[model samples]
Target: MQTPTPSPGQAVLAQVLAMLQPLVVWLLRSGVGYTELTAALKPVFLEAARAELARIGGKQTDSAVSLLSGVHRKDVRAFGQTARAVDVRAQLGKPTPASQVMTRWLASDWPDSLPFSGLERSFEALARAVSKDMHPRALLLELVRLGVVLEEEGQVRLCRQAFVPNPSLEESRRLLAGSVADHIEAGVHNLSASDGKTYLEQSVFADGLSPASVQQLEQLANSLWRDVLAAMVQAAVPLCEQDEPAGGNQRIRLGMFCLSAPMELNAPNNNPPDGDGDAPHAKDTR
Candidate 1:
């Protein structure tokens, strides 16, 4: 006897589970159990159903949503009665005043170290250029807190070329969530696209590499990204300014990620292990 091929939905579910493994690990670390996750998922399912219905020009009645979402009609009705939360994309994608200031400084090719306040080429001028609504002092404090800049003797210096936040900070988790969400959204859109359009979703995969090779590749990738980042920022700033007066509603995020791990993790064993496997663990460089 031979096993039958799984249906498309079943096959996709398996793939999704594989992709979700890291998320599950994070959830466990954060103490979010099954019950909490399930409870949170109900609202998300309902929202997705509503969006799908709108996309297909279908009537968005409670029964229709329930039928599509597998959520109970009562729950759907209750959900509709409550105010919807702010869109996650908006919350995640909108850069802070501090971020805008940092981007401006980086793109302008200004000195990395600038006086906090002065007549010419000061940090305050950069912050004020990004937005006058927020005081420069407040923005500086935020940048310092995120470990992106340093302040000593009234001079502010860029500490990191990139806005890499400390992993322990809440702001770091928020950024991680935003980047992961956009990356997955692009992948999903490519998979389901019906108009022959596709987002850029591609990667290079390799194995059987020694640790030294991995390290060398990692350095190469970082150098490549820095060049790409500077070019994109320089090109994008003027285009954004041109679009703003025209009431543009679009935003874009370009990102790259690299992961290298022990080959065993990539190729899981079919049989259960009585103890942890023999693979050496790799420290997370991110």
Candidate 2:
């Protein structure tokens, strides 16, 4: 059997479909319908068209956007005039009950590792201090769910220094949109670069590893990623603490991730280890 060579357009279309499969799968699992996806993509498609025109130094008008975006001119105008829909859940930033509880636990004066009940400086007292309207028990349960605190022997202990409230539906939706958008934007920017200059978009990948080797690789990668995370977080903390001077609104996001999985299941492994099986894998500090 032979596979026929596809035309350039056919090849690109196939690539797009292949790349979109995982996202579609996620959307389906998340209970988002195709119609909902289409609605969300409209503004994104329009924005993409606007970006393309700007890249080429072309004028971007409602009609031009409609033509480039394949959207009706009226719809395009409406999208431009309308305020972007905001996710109400995302606005409840850091000062949430979970963060307050964790921050209070980290305070120098607080020191009670045992299960706290009616003590003067107990878990309930601390939760009550920061939780405001929420009950102490409710705050404690939420904290446990978020992995921010642990309860044992009638006392609660802080597990994580940072507060990451359990991501609700809207939080997950926002993260889905933001992270994938940035990732695709990086890829697109690199693809459209004609001057041989590029951003720091890179990944290390390889196949043909045994399960043992894969485990070793994962550990090595985890160590390297942890070091990078620590350095970046340390650098970011000072910036967060500094006073915000009056200026135009500007924000930045730094994202890094690591993935390791079998590329194909049931693939034959021909290569075997030559050295001691316990030999350490090469470490990458970066």
Candidate 3:
């Protein structure tokens, strides 16, 4: 009775499925309604469907070719074009015209500090580019429904800023803390510790945890910390991407100390006779 091993493709698919499963579960737990879920799942499901269709078609499977054979030919084609447009914009290091228009409106002189009216026009333009028959208002509404946008003082704006490419140390620590808070709020109570050191120890060195679980948690923490550092650097220092690494490393190390000191002091191993006198006290003035 030997267990059969999965092929490389199957192994990759399994990891993807595992990652996606938690997200799906979280969505269901958050009380997302059927209609909202359907709309949200549309792009993902369609992409998977198209991939599967091509897989079945052997080497001759072009998504563009297979898309035209389907009833929703126009939609598939439009999606492909929009994806290309987004890629080109990213490569050019500039926002799409719609993004620029929206940003200008955000920075404009509306009676309210936030500009919702301008966002509506930008959303319309974005929707039109996606599908000629698609209603911009509906698309915007859908985004709102999905909790990706917020309405304030008659102005619609992003619920959160886009990811910053690289971050400073202080920013990294803040982001990591924020991510921990978010996870706790979302019922991932396992990692909730009074201090950063305890949290890291529990997350990293806890007994009986699987290697896979440890790896996943480490990756999540690293990603969250990186995002925080990047945002802080962008806001406070605005360094070029090439100039970010040293600052980012310095900040992250500082953040680790800020978070870990309290936990280390509280641990049973504290006040060991062999401890180095030169080591900085947790409360020592910098």
Candidate 4:
């Protein structure tokens, strides 16, 4: 007997289900159920449908949007114009002052310790360089409060190489949303593009790894990310300054992630390594 092939929509839905697993886990853990999710998604679906229709030079009437998005015509027509006019990205809020200082510290060639006040190579100078709107002392206090740094005898000592706010905090939640939203947006853009433009969204996947090997691979990923982060920041700073004076109409995000999980017992086995010891099966999304 031969296996039956799925239709295009069925195949896409299958992949979408796989992609939604992690998000569903998050939603359930946060006490959001299917009803709440569907309610929240109504406006989003209409907005996305309108955008798609505009992109393809189709009519953006309520009926057209409803047909494209599978949303009811009444709901599409009822979507408040005022709400639709608001910029969604602006609602995420800007990065905190402490995170800004932390990023510059990690990316720059500055020393681990700097005096509170000085004209050159000081904590005050670094903070002001990032933003003149915020006082350096206030930024230092914020970082200290977050346990990211320590102030000793007028010198601020770096407590860690990276800064991560408490997960339960609102700041961390917003940050996560912003990052994940951009990642999904990139993938959506690539999927819908007709002109061949694409963003770099590749990942390498391998299965059947021991726990120890997975841990080692995670460490390697972190090490590699540190190098990439520093290099990208160094290359981007001058360009950003140059662009800001010319209106700064664009932005960029470079991210890296790693996940390891045990394979299901009933799942098909991945192909073993060839004679050359190279794994024969690896998933690469480009």
Give all candidate RMSDs, comma-separated.
5.4, 7.2, 17.4, 3.8
> In terms of TM-score, which candidate is strongest?
4
For lDDT, the strongest prediction is: 1
- 105-201: candidate 3 lDDT, tens digit per residue: 3333322233433664554544464445656566566556545466665656665453232234333334444543343333323333333342222
My TM-score estimates for the predictions, one after another, are 0.85, 0.61, 0.27, 0.86
Clashing pairs in 3: 116-155, 116-156, 166-230, 167-229, 167-230, 168-229, 169-251, 169-252, 171-228, 172-229
Model 1 CA deviation exceeding 4 Å by range: 81-86, 106-108, 161-163, 265-286
By summed lDDT, which 10 consecutive residues of candidate 2 come out lowest? Answer: 85-94
RMSD of 3: 17.4
After TM-score superposition, the amount by which residue 15's alpha carbon in candidate 3 deviates from its true location, in angstroms, is 1.5
Ranking of models by lDDT? 1, 4, 2, 3
What lDDT is obtained when candidate 3 is compared to the true structure? 0.45
Candidate 2, after superposition: displacement of residue 248 in Å? 7.8
- Residue 153's lDDT within candidate 4 is 97
Q: What does candidate 1's lDDT look like per residue over 131-189, in tens digits?
A: 78989999999988777899999999997655655668765677678888888888899
Residue ranges of candidate 2 with Cα displaced over 4 Å: 1-12, 54-57, 77-80, 83-142, 151-173, 193-197, 243-250, 265-286
